[model samples]
Target: MNEVAILCVDDETVILESLQEQISRHFGEQFMYEAAESAEEALEIIEELNQEGVKIVVIVSDWLMPGMRGDELLVKVHQQFGDITTIMLTGQADEKAIERAKREANLYCCIHKPWRKEELLKIITTALESV
Candidate 1:
């Protein structure tokens, strides 16, 4: 997997845009950011990019979504792309979901809603470095 690629998935358009803007603003051209509004869309992007021979480094997803929750989507991602790091961003996540994600998806970390840009950037940088 390419280490400079980042994928972000969230159903909320505003949140997704904010993520893209914040990550870009903080890191500049250090990493490429790709965003999707849903798990289905994210999977399609993954497949398309994979066919183009590009590997993604990480996926930061929202925990609460319209269809597949972040944990479920991460699990599916882990199934197909085990080496890619995964993080969940959510305001409504519970202990059970965290436990499941940790075990099944090997989720690298969780970021709470309304995240601070610096803190979120640090978390992602750390996660990427460790992986």
Candidate 2:
């Protein structure tokens, strides 16, 4: 079977760790979980994984970051890798950013910060099903 990955990008290390842990716990060993501290790092990871023949099926990203914003990253990803599913996880994102992501990136869903584990898992499950 082809290897698949799930990438979580956030500027906060704690958030990234929490997301990776929660997703791994819920999904077991079904997917390779990756965490990046910035959009640039996330893009690097995505490219490296693709080089290794691992398809990244989902990306969950925080909106406000130092460099490229999550929505911008998602839109770039959508342009380069149209098949990957993108989700926004943000506490401070405005409606316009979310709408832009939805319109341009085909965002799978937008989950607010302090998201319930169940909701995150459900959205991920749905995204995987769609993939």
The C-alpha RMSD of each candidate to the native structure, in angstroms, is 1.9, 1.2
* Cα lDDT of model 2 by residue, 1-131, tens digit: 44999999999999999999999999988989999999999999999998999999999999999989999999999999999999999999999999999999999999999999999999999999989
Report lDDT (CA) for all predictions: 0.88, 0.96
After superposition, the stretches of candidate 2 with alpha carbons farther than 4 Å from their true spots are none
Indicate the residue-level lDDT of 78 in model 1.
94
Sliding window of 10 residues with minimal summed lDDT for model 1: 1-10
User: How far does residue 81 in candidate 2 sit from its true spot (Å)?
Assistant: 0.5
- Candidate 1 lDDT over 22-110, as tens digits, reads 88787787777899999889999888878877788889999888888999999999999998899899999998998899999998889
Per-residue lDDT of 130 in model 1: 84
| The candidate that achieves the highest lDDT relative to the unseen native structure | 2
The TM-scores of all predictions, comma-separated, are 0.93, 0.97
User: CA lDDT of 23 in candidate 2?
Assistant: 97
